[model samples]
Target chain A: SCYLIPNKMVPGDSNKECTDLKGNKHPLNSRWQTENCDECDCLEKEISCCSLVAIPVGYDKDNCQKIFKQEDCKYIVVEKKDPNKTCDVSQWI
Target chain B: SCYLIPNKMVPGDSNKECTDLKGNKHPLNSRWQTENCDECDCLEKEISCCSLVAIPVGYDKDNCQKIFKQEDCKYIVVEKKDPNKTCDVSQWI
Candidate 1:
């Protein structure tokens, strides 16, 4: 799976980069982009980099709390597909 | 070494969480109060979260460009202490 996160656009190119699940790419430094990110559905820097840990919306308010409660758990940014809060965060790199 | 990032305060306890550079901590759920973050030096949410990448200020404008040229490069966020535009990005969860 390839996840691309758009950047906040510092001063240069407002481009998006995606790589294999292994985090490796062909051209190496992310200069050679496959698709014209501009063609993507999202807008500008709004679609930049993927959130390091995509926090689920209703995570604590629903599911996790029932199982973990105030036990305090390590933060894990895993993809959530339950019917709870259904956080839809499609991140790019 | 622990690099804790203060978050953009969403409406709860304004605290900071620091983990080992290896990305692990003792009491996970991050509720334990190791230290009152207020005791630290920085300001409010400004210290909340750490940048996923502490982009070196002089990164492309100096070093890497000399070696990799305009061919494009992979984005690797590393702690920079160079003479050039050194970027100090202390990130957190």
Candidate 2:
């Protein structure tokens, strides 16, 4: 879901554009994906973001690791010692 | 991805089971889905939870609303004024 990151109150700016945490400005009503894979909206007073990827968790952390698939915007659980081997992921969030 | 919610440091307890925030005890290595749709794992020191559903965001919030489908563990963007009409979802997290 979307979570709003409130903008630092600027004394007189009531514009619809938004400024992200990185200090990058985006035009009003614009939508973009961050470098960290969060889809964000440029609102009037806040920057709203939602994760674009679902992370796989609840796996055997001792033997498995989660890897991000940048192309698909999701994660895969695999054997830590062998990337080619898949691991059982109990859940994703 | 998994987010750890550390349990209160209870003195003298080193058990393998975990006590959730709701005070529910779960055995170590056991995984369960919470009523809120989060998939959690019972670890020794903390409860690790992952969201099982990808929430739709970046939609026209002023005109559309999100509806959760429990059976499918996903969300649908629909017209706020008319649930029967589908809305365009800009992204899902």
lDDT of 1 by residue, B30-90 (tens): 3332211111223343222222222222333322211111113223333233424433324
Q: Which digits, one per residue and each the tens of the lDDT, describe model 2 over residues A26-65? A: 8888999864367988777556678787766478988876
State fnat for each of the candidate structures.
Answer: 0.00, 0.00
CAPRI classification of candidate 1:
incorrect
Model 2, which residues run further than 4 Å from truth? B1-93
lDDT of each: 0.28, 0.70
| Stretches of candidate 1 exceeding 4 Å from the true structure | A1-53, A61-93, B1-84
The complex in candidate 1 yields a DockQ of 0.04
- Estimate how well candidate 2 is docked, as a DockQ score: 0.03
Best by lDDT: 2
> Residue by residue across A1-93, what tens digits does model 1's lDDT show?
112333335677654543332233322243332211111123343222222222232333322221111113223232233424433334322
